[model samples]
Target: MEDEIITDGKYRYIEIGEGKPIIILHGLMGGLSNFQGVTHFFPTKGYQVLVPELPIYDMPMLKTTVKNFAKFLEEFIAHKGLKDVILLGNSLGGHIGLLHTKLFPEKIKALVITGSSGLYESAMGDGYPKRGDYEFIKKKAQDVFYDPKVATKEIVDEVFATVNDRMKLVKTLAIAKSAIRHNMAKDLPNMQTPTCIIWGKQDNVTPPNVAEEFHELLPDSELFWIDKCGHAPMMEHPEQFNQILDAWLVKRGF
Candidate 1:
């Protein structure tokens, strides 16, 4: 098969399917291809999927800030002339989704944020330091797993590989520096579109209470907590994720 491309001078996207657009955003260490498994299900469900690697991940973007990154998305969508896309984002992507909706509510149909990052103040937890390095992320990722025994060597290696990836780490640090300074709690109440939030009940990365707090703030939002899963609930529990996604889609007339 030949590779297809969606380019607009400065950026490009690889997309698939045909129907109402469902744009998926990957997290800090993720790329557009990360959505392949999840997007596979959407195509069958009749969703024209567009997974754009955010500017920080997209090779062309250099020295990007949160504001410019948001603009990059707007430009990408405008370049493609897409409208009424359902925005589905995970982790860092979720922060972008929220920012995008705030900037152009008319362009998106709905929002689904899973294990989202970038909305809380940086603070020390009960027994942990406020800021930890790779060790912290690794430990936290492990704790998110429902069964600690299931946090296999493979998973640990993958997580370590992700943080240690050169480009991925740069993106992570740069975005951390310029992202709307977290605290989206104040903005949630203003969101007009219906939103569905999914989180792993065992997610130490972003606790269930945090997801619930988002739901409470968003006037029109629902929460689904997948059991026996962790930070990456979509991957850890795809079946439950799909069921919740479809039900939310049906409920919202998407």
Candidate 2:
């Protein structure tokens, strides 16, 4: 996926297949590779899957907010000349997609969120004060999934590096704070975009109730559950995730 990323000016992304666009948004500590199953499976199903490298740490400190990330997604969509896109995001990425759709609903056809963090602040995780502790970071990373082994060495190492870097750490915290500040509870009722909420039943980060709240608040939404899955349903249960989303898309005629 890294080699396939197209670097167009400041924007870097991976575009696969050809048909209706399904732009993927990665989480706060997640990379484009987290969606390997999604990027691979969707294209064959006749959807153009795109995973953009969100500038989680590239923006100026003051501008590093969830709102700005949503705006950046808007800019990326325009740059690619894409419209009627179906946004599929996890964790912080899901929050950004929700905000983007609220701000610019005209271009989006549907929304899919898993382990998203719009209504819960704890979803961002407590501050990483033990940035120097490898074991601590490793445990934190492993806790993201129901099966601890899913947090591969590469994934833990990437998380370790991000927290250890001073600039990235500050930006990460800034984004977390921004996410808390930009809660979408008040805005969800008004946003009429159809949504697919696939949640990990065992998701401790966002918790199961968060998905229920989202479904209850949103005007048009359907919720699906994956047992024994956590935070990232697409990663832990990619097959189930794809099946649910695919069926939902077909049912919605998207």
Cα lDDT of candidate 2 equals 0.93
Candidate 2 residue-wise lDDT, 1-254, digit = tens: 35388999999999999999999999999988888888999999999999999999999999999999999999999999999999999999999999999999999999999999999947546655477899989999989999999999999999999889999988988999899999999999999999999999999999999999999999999999999999999999999999999999999999
Most accurate candidate by lDDT:
2
Superposed model 2: Cα runs more than 4 Å off: 1-3, 124-127
- Quote model 1's TM-score: 0.80
**Model 1 accuracy (lDDT, Cα):** 0.73
Which has the greatest TM-score?
Answer: 2
The C-alpha lDDT values of all candidates are: 0.73, 0.93
**After aligning candidate 2 to the native by TM-score, how far in Å is the CA of 144 from where it should be?**
0.5
State each model's C-alpha RMSD to the native: 4.3, 1.1
